[model samples]
Target: MEVAKILHMVGGVGETSYALNSTLQKKAMHIAKPIVQQSISQLYCKLQPTESLTIADLGCSCGPTTFITISEIMDEIYEVCHRLSCQVPELTFFLNDLPGNDFNSIFKYLPTYDKMVKKEKGSKYAPYYVVGVPGSFYGRLLPEESIHFVHSSYSLHWLSQVPRGLEDDSGAPVNRGNIYIDDTSPPAVIKSYVAQFKQDFSTFLSLRSKEIVSGGQMVITSLGRSDVDPLGGEVNCLYGLLAKALNSLVSEGVVDKEKVDAFDLPLYAPAIEEVKELVQNEGSFEFYQAKVFELNWDPFDDQMDDFVADSFVSGENAMKTIRAVMEPMLANHFGGAVMDALFSRYAMNVAEHLKKEKTKYVNFTVALTKRG
Candidate 1:
């Protein structure tokens, strides 16, 4: 699959769109806000007094949190300038995502966002400019040495493509009966995924190193695994459940089994060590902070839980969140006819699994500085 073409959050402001279904992502951004603020502040201290500052938010999908994140970063910079008695710099903001992302949804809110910044910052607000640049972050997307700070959240785990060599010499699927790397996947499948991550991440760092000025800072938060072993994390369980749902449909002849075998999600939740190794090997940035954190599987589950009743509701909510992000790619690959049924089965499987045990998503946040 061509990930650049197919990977995008569900568009529009309707019920199934990412705008409505992204509470989990919003929560993740809130959790990482403090780190983001600190990174900006520190980078500000290192920056020479200038009339303008350029910042980029990579993988900024359309949602309330997209503007929220930009606002928060601007606030941090304003605070730093206040303390130093420096004139607030003119702000140039680049909001980037895959080309297929819903830029219109994000653009619609810019007027309100600008007014909010002006209201909060008063006369001290910098002359702010925002532009949408659509492309993959795994390659160069900006002019050289232009960005002073970079921030990305709840992205970066998505690989550029499904890892190569998931087929045998005769071209049969090697990862049969599984849609992702699982405990049962062969060592070859595991190695292929890891190798892909290393290459993609290294390229990401290299391109950013060229685009960011020396001493600039980058903060990233993405779905990751706490376990050193790639196969032993909550992400594996999540995809495993998805695979089960697909298998059930295959059994009932509602979906083609061979189609399932040919499909693999273009995602990999890297271990912290693997991330650290890539940063070190790439030799362009200093890793200032790297930590793993946990979030509940169902971030929206606030009500009282009757194991039987709430499980279904919680499962449905979880499925919606996944659907908002994954549905586009799935529908393109698996055909739209089966999606409603596929997710229905997925919801039940998740509901049943949650009844037995609580599940959490492991997340990793890292802060880096471009080397001189």
Candidate 2:
């Protein structure tokens, strides 16, 4: 599958839209707000640009979370400038995502977003401007040495394409029953994923290195695992359950087993250290700090209890969240007809698993600066 052509969150502002089901991403961003604020403050103080500052939010999906990020960034800049007694610069924002992203839906809300920014900035700086740049962030998207600060939240885990080398010499799929890295995945399957991440991330950093001006900062928050072992994380169990849901349909002869065997998620959540080492290896950015945190799979379940208080409700919410992010890809591979039933089965499986153990998604955030 051509990931750039097909990968996008469910669009529109409907019940199943990513706009409504993106609380998990919003929560992750909120949890990493300190890092974001610090990065923005550092960039502002470091350059102290008086005329203009350009920012880019990579993988800016069509959701409220996207605007919230831009808003928070502008507010932080305003606060930092006021506190430091410096001139607040005119801000230019480049909102980037894959071509398939719902740029129209995002544009629809810009009028409101612009009004809010205008009121807050008052007469100090010119109005904040947003440019929707549709393209894969894995490559160059901005002019050379143009950006001041970059922010990407809850993205970058997705590989540019499905990992290569998933098949044996005889050409049989290596990971037959699983969709992502799991306990059952062989050594070759695991190696293939790591190789893919290394290549993609290095390319991303190299391209951005040419775009972001010297001393500019970048903050990346994406789905990740804290565990050293790739197979030993909450995300493994989550996708494993989805694979089981597909297998259930196969068992019932509702879908072909070959199709399930052929499908694998084009995503790999790296460990926090893995990201640091990759940046160091790429030789473009200085990795300052990295952190790992976890959130309940049901984003709405904020309590720290070790038990699922309402398995059914939690399962429904989890299903909706995953569906909003993944339905388009699943529909592309498995056909739109199977999506309703497949996710229904997935919900039941998640509910059953939650009854046994409450699982969460591990997240990683990194702060970096482009080397001069």
Candidate 3:
């Protein structure tokens, strides 16, 4: 249930959610659809004529984009089936998210799909059925050896929770900021996160190995940073801006600064090397293809045609929309008491950033594979 709840928190109609809904979804889809198609082609190439292909949309937040991803997969399947003279395999789609996700919203979109399937009855397009599995992907959410393809977008980096000991003062001394970055991270924070990723990925591979059958394929893509950042480091820029706003509230006596800093923002951005290490250790999946792609995806980036589209209109309205979008996250991240103050800080910063820093280079990563 916490997983589901967190999905809603991340996907619900708020600043973070709105950004996902408005900008991030569009950017992710542009890259994800094509890569998924490529992965499907690769999978089909290694498949036997008698084997049926299956697909899954993992970490699918609540939105039509999920359907779009599924649609692309189906289209790819359709094309491959036609070319290879292979019959459309019975398609079983597992739409997975946390227990607190907006399943109802996601489910509502399924009937239209079912209706389309009915209209095409007796056709060879393949029968596709979608069912919601509410649980965490860090563990096995599907029956072993039952899936043909697995895909998750912009979702893998978030750990179940912040790494431990980053905030604790029980030992030598205490500090603020992310624990994994602290100079005194108990010597285990990084290892712990990496270990968890290894374990989670191992379970993913082991379960997928069973579900995928031999020769099946899986494609996963999400945000990843460079192994080495010559600059300060890889920071979740949006999250950092958010943190700054929250901290500003605390400094202004509008919220508790200590609590704001203490609250861990659940996220992780591993490098390509880390990804390689995880996959190499698992050994269940063969290294098919891997690459770090620079995606021009962030809406807030300078490439936007309308950074301040409403210059002619009152600045008050623009600020209002921004506040509407960010308030919920501030409230959820900090608390209602200081939510307004936090948003105010964010608004001031955004106004200043619009006038100063504005540029256009947001990057992402893509990884493709086949069942080894």
Count clashing residue pairs per candidate. Answer: 0, 0, 13
Model 3 C-alpha lDDT per residue in residues 1-372, reported as the tens digit of each score = 132344343445454453344455556666666677888777766664645666777777676667777778777877888898877776778888877666777777688876775675447656667888887776677676677678877667766655545534454323354323333334455555555555665666666666666666777776666644312124444344456676666667776756655565445666777677777777777766665654322343434553554322322323444343334434565666765566566556555544444322233545445444
TM-score of each: 0.96, 0.97, 0.79
Candidate 1 per-residue C-alpha lDDT over 122-229 given as tens digits, one digit per residue, 9 for 90 to 100 = 889679899999999987999999999999998899999999989889999999889899888889999999999999999999999999999999999999888888
Model 2 scores worst on lDDT over the 10 consecutive residues at 119-128
Q: Please identify model 3 stretches exceeding 4 Å from their true place.
A: 1-22, 48-51, 115-124, 169-203, 227-234, 296-333, 337-341, 347-364, 368-371
lDDT of 2 at 283: 93
After superposition, the stretches of candidate 1 with alpha carbons farther than 4 Å from their true spots are 302-309
Q: List the residue pairs that clash in candidate 1.
A: none
Q: Which one wins on TM-score?
A: 2
lDDT of 2 by residue, 185-219 (tens): 89989999999999999999999999999888999
Report how far residue 335 has shifted in candidate 3, in Å: 2.4
Per-candidate Cα RMSD to the true structure, in Å, reads 1.9, 1.3, 4.8
Worst 10 residues of 1 by lDDT: 301-310
Q: What stretches of model 2 exceed 4 Å from their correct place? A: none
- Sorted on TM-score, best first, the list reads 2, 1, 3
